[model samples]
Target: MKALMTLALVSTMAAGLAGCVVAPNSGSIYTSRQAQNEQTVRIATVESVREVRIDKGNSGTGALTGAALGGLAGSTVGGGNGSVAAGILGAVAGGLAGDNVEANMKRHAGVEITVRLDSGELRAITQDADELFRPGERVRLLSDGRKTRVTH
Candidate 1:
């Protein structure tokens, strides 16, 4: 019983830690002026605000953690040969279940921002919507070579 409880505790902690993410956000950086780089900065008008969801794709941490926990729990179930078989079966089953749970937990809340550029081009970018934005508000589109973000 104690082993089972310990396994559960460890699995829970691992899953929680794996779900955390540190993502970029829009913020006001007080600067003398917009610094030019290889990046592009464009002025755009918010055309619409639509709620979006981001899937932080799983890397299988949950499965590995669950397998370890389940094997421990299953080992406590029987003796000798029976214990080994149960442990392997338990590990496989637990790993599958944990992966499913983790995928569900990793779904993130976001917003899809549709903007019309000054040159009359329409562009959309989805990001973590921690900050509120509205239609017709002026925002800046900052794009490096890799990713793009919208800021107020």
Candidate 2:
């Protein structure tokens, strides 16, 4: 009964932790800092597009949450010293699993768009694959001098 409850708690915590995942860096999405800022816009022709994987990286929340939950669950395994050992083992294992889970969840599909500016310069911008681009397509490039994105 206790172990079952702990399992339920662990599931709940993991699910909750997933909510903290970062938002996609899609062309349509903007950070608060990026909002209300003027960006330079230029016209460009798409030269090529490639599928990519965007890894947002981990924030350690998943590992920490998993460790705590795993420790609590594992500690219920045995009595005395055995329980302590189990908790430690569970923590290490859970942390690794959680980290992997978080990383996999944070990984998103992206695109590498190579474009030719009207000025005849070539540029490639990688971003979340929220929109599609194809060769010979005319697109608008928006930049804040630091970040750039391509859009239809």
Candidate 3:
């Protein structure tokens, strides 16, 4: 039915919006800006590794998308005046739901790595948990002054 199709479309849009929340922040993935750029590489020993969560903050994309879909779906609910009210209500509810969804989606598993550099200085770097690290393990810390990452 038309309603089912609308639901499917809304679901698809929400999923696409959620997909936009994640980016390549892993140690192996490099951005276009990071490519061809020189980074300072240093040897370090892992002092401690702790699991953390990374939140990349929302960009309002999800809420906007959800509101549009919800308003469209709600307008089909009843007669003229009732439909307008339903659409408004749907939009508000959808926006809040969408924002919550986006916040959850944007959170990524990360690790806070405490390392002791060869210079005897201690630094803690937080990055995506895609790579594994263990205490006392030797790792490479690559930095470009702005960003840093740990790799084996």
Candidate 4:
């Protein structure tokens, strides 16, 4: 019971963290502060759009979750000293399964947008592919000294 709750909580946290990848959110607008801090802005024409899958590297949350759930399940397998051994074994096996599951689930579908700047320089930005962008569309490239984003 306790193990299941822990597993649920950890799973939720892991998913939330994985979903927090810094992609240019659809229709995300820059705040006034962000606009003031931008290093550069440019107008660009989309040259190409390619679908991609972005991997969110494992942070070990899944393995821990699996271990907890597995240990709980294993604890019921046998009696006395044997139960302890089963729980330990279950934890190890569960951890590996959890890690793999987390890795696969953490990947995000994204897009690589290739654009040509007015000055003829070419750049490509990869972001979560939630919104469809077409080639030849005019977009504003927003940068805040570190990351860059393109928007209509």
Taking the tens digit of each residue's C-alpha lDDT, what string does model 3 give over 89-128?
8888887887787788888899999999999999999998
TM-score against truth, every candidate: 0.73, 0.84, 0.85, 0.75
lDDT of 4 by residue, 88-148 (tens): 8988998889888878877878889999999999999987786778998998888767778
- The residue pairs in collision within model 3 are none
Rank all candidate structures by their lDDT, best first, as comma-separated numbers: 2, 3, 4, 1
Question: On residues 1-152, what C-alpha lDDT tens digit does candidate 1 reach at each position?
Answer: 76666867686757656554434443333233334456688999999989988788786777777676677768778899999899898889888877787787778678999999999999998887777789999999888766677888
Regions of candidate 2 where Cα sits further than 4 Å from its true position: 1-19
lDDT at 115 for candidate 3? 99
RMSD of candidates 1 onward, in order: 5.6, 4.0, 4.2, 4.5
| Global lDDT scores for all candidate models | 0.76, 0.85, 0.85, 0.77
lDDT of 3: 0.85
TM-score for predicted model 2 compared with the true structure: 0.84
Residue ranges of candidate 3 with Cα displaced over 4 Å: 1-22
lDDT of 2 at 9: 68
Cα deviation of 136, candidate 3, in Å? 0.5
lDDT of 4 at 98: 86
